[model samples]
Target: MFKKVPILIFFFLIFFVSFEDLYSKDEYFLTLRNEKVNLRQGPSFDYPVKILYKKKFLPVLIQDSSDNFRKIRDHENNSGWVHISQLSKKKAAIVIEEELILFGKSTIFSNPVALLKQGRLVKINKCKIEWCKVKTGKYKGWVSKNGLWGLL
Candidate 1:
């Protein structure tokens, strides 16, 4: 019994420390996992649905959490509660500029493939100094980093 005490304490400390790092310190970026999720006024299903998020991989700021529910703020500054299960750790970004040109490569000389309007959501695959490789469905290209949000 005495020999088991130190072993148990060691395991408990390891578990606690790792669990502490599992959640965000204050605010962190999370993405919508499903194509559609319901945002409610409160942390429980008893609350009425306040909005419907139909965009998958949309970046959202997690401001608070209670149990399995998390309070999130969208790019439009809308606040609501969503179930944590509907959220993913994948990072994404929203186009903040009124209009942004999606380039074929990460340079101004690259051919423009599409024009992304503001509020458009794209998964951030990687980023460089002033450009980010983004994708939404079949649209994959680079966009100026200055026009995006949800990155550090």
Candidate 2:
């Protein structure tokens, strides 16, 4: 029994550190900590354009980096970079706070432009700067990243 105790403690320590990283998914999975935040035009300290963001509304968490700007996507599927000051610790998933939003593109491997005639439900894969890589079931492509909700 004494010999097994050391082994068990080693396993426990390893699990504690790596286990938390397993669910490091980014989305607006967190809610805003404060009532409101300023939506800036760019992701740096210099760019300070005041865009309107709702109070307590969650914004998508795209990526965590060394810069103060945290990339996020909006409800329209439009992706952009926001200041880190706009974020909150409260984590959550998106819920339909408004009406049903239609997708503009369809799934066609050869005819991407033609397929995007109507809207559809998309599963987001990830994001880059201002573009969100998403899959509308059959079609995997890029969208503006503003179509989906932040954390609900």
Which ranges in model 1 have alpha carbons more than 4 Å from their true place? 1-25
**What TM-score, to 2 decimals, does candidate 1 have?**
0.76
Q: Model 2, range 1-152, lDDT digits (tens) per residue?
A: 99999999999988976776654453334444456665555777576655555645454556544377766665456455666666666433342323323233432222342133323334556665644555544656655444445423
- Minimum summed lDDT over a 10-residue window in model 2 is located at 106-115
Error of 1 at 46 (Å): 2.0
Q: Which residues of candidate 2, in runs, are more than 4 Å off? A: 1-28, 64-66, 97-152
Q: How many pairs of residues collide in each model? A: 0, 23
Whole-structure CA lDDT of model 1: 0.92
Best by lDDT: 1
